[model samples]
Target: MNKKYLFIFTIVIVIFAAFFLLTKKPQQKNTDILINGKKLQVELMQTEEEKTKGLSDRKNLCSNCGLLFVYNQEGFYSFWMRKMYFDIDILWINKDRVVDITYDAKKPEVDEFESPRTIYQNKVPADKVLEVNAGWVEKNGIKVGETIVFK
Candidate 1:
């Protein structure tokens, strides 16, 4: 009787564990960006909701941290400083190659929150746009022709 009860307990535990695992949501994949032989930890903004909230309400960013905005096709996209506290470097990227660079985009003034926002746009169309800390482009030797490999 003891062995039979133990077997039933084990089966119950396995069933509960399987049910718990199956009910859990799938985890999202992390976006890894490698540029100029350097790997950067990035947050991907694939959906419109995520892209619209790009780096806003942030006070600072760590070194080598990036916000990657992904699009379906290469097109002209305009960005504006909404609620950022520090400056950022915006890069226009098409696939693995860099298309353009907008260095040191200034932070918006808190006093001017009700005023017109400053728009930042690149000259060419880009399938992806990368936003990093200001001066990161020059410090990391990132150039327009450099390829960014995503993993």
Candidate 2:
């Protein structure tokens, strides 16, 4: 092989190795939640970091994977595409565990979609919010008045 070609091959191999070593698999923690007496095994996003990173950059979500957000007070809440890479369905819940509303959140794109100078709106009022893969709620037939218990 020519010396120049050999050097290029070596550089490519080094770059590939660096990329493989620098990328880490995301850690998924588990928690249990009950919906109308039916238990669901879900991944927990309890910490500030985890909550902030909620579903962002994830190429896919497991069938039952979800993020549960616990708020200090009940009010109209909204979420934005922000840094998200995939679309999600937001399930808004009140203190009584009743499903009050559902919103289809937009998927994040490569370009910035949020307006920097304006306040964005939330789709529903809620004390607690559950985010799942887009269409999960409809596919599972989850509806208003359904109750959720976190365990």
Of the candidates shown, which would achieve the greatest TM-score relative to the real structure? 1
lDDT of 1 by residue, 57-145 (tens): 88788897989998999999999887788899999999889999999999888775434378999798899999999999999899998
Model 2 Cα lDDT, one tens digit per residue, 27-68: 657788877555667776667686666666677777777777
Where is model 1 poorest over a 10-residue stretch in terms of lDDT? 108-117
By summed lDDT, the worst window of 10 consecutive residues in model 2 runs over: 113-122
What CA root-mean-square deviation does each model show from the true structure? 5.1, 10.9
User: Relative to the unseen true structure, what is the Cα RMSD of model 2?
Assistant: 10.9
What lDDT would each prediction earn against the true structure? 0.88, 0.69
Provide the global lDDT of candidate 1 against the true structure: 0.88
What TM-score fits each model? 0.81, 0.63
